[model samples]
Target: MPQNQPTNKIQNPETSVPKTPEMNERDFLNDMLTTEKYMTGSYNVALNEASNQTLYQDLATIFKETQDCQRNLYNLMFKNGWYAVDQAEQPKVQNAYQQFSGYKNQLPYAVQ
Candidate 1:
């Protein structure tokens, strides 16, 4: 509780589990989340390289579903405090925005 410490962390109470070698709910969910992430990445590659229109559409649908599942798993883990992320500082965010703001002008097409 100091001014120098960051205050933007958002988390829920973490569920307690045994520390033994046995797998727990958190472990299973974490595994599944990792699998989903990998699947989504593979699907993205397939979608990009798809040659047939029909296959591309099908892959796109499956990609969206896989992405959604990944998001849900992430949300569940975050809600259970299994996942933690630091919020970006306002000044740093503004700095990044300012740094990127001029790049839009370099684009070939007009943006709005």
Candidate 2:
């Protein structure tokens, strides 16, 4: 062991954005997952704050986008004729979308 040298140092990789468009199924699915995560986060934060109108609107938009992405993804899968017999988890996704829509509908409206 050298006395003057640094030991066991880990370095983080540089963050570079992807330049090319992703056209594959895996890439599309990853994008959908990312959008869903962001939407859920925005919705939770808006609910937490409870008073930010801008955040509330943003959350609503994100919620719509996430739901649309999910639905379209499934539709594409169905279009490709890939049917799975074990699909107990799909209803839950629909339920979540309905619940989020309900929440959006119930938001307080102030006439200014």
lDDT of 1: 0.91
Candidate 2 lDDT for residue 24: 60
lDDT scores of the candidates, listed in order: 0.91, 0.61
TM-score of 1: 0.88
> Best candidate, lDDT-wise?
1
RMSD of each: 2.5, 16.9
lDDT of 1 at 20: 79
Clashing pairs in 2: none
| Residue ranges of candidate 2 with Cα displaced over 4 Å | 1-27, 30-50, 82-112
Please name the candidate that would achieve the greatest TM-score relative to the true structure. Answer: 1
Clashing pairs for predicted structure model 1, backbone only:
none
Which residue segments of model 1 deviate by more than 4 Å? Answer: 1-8
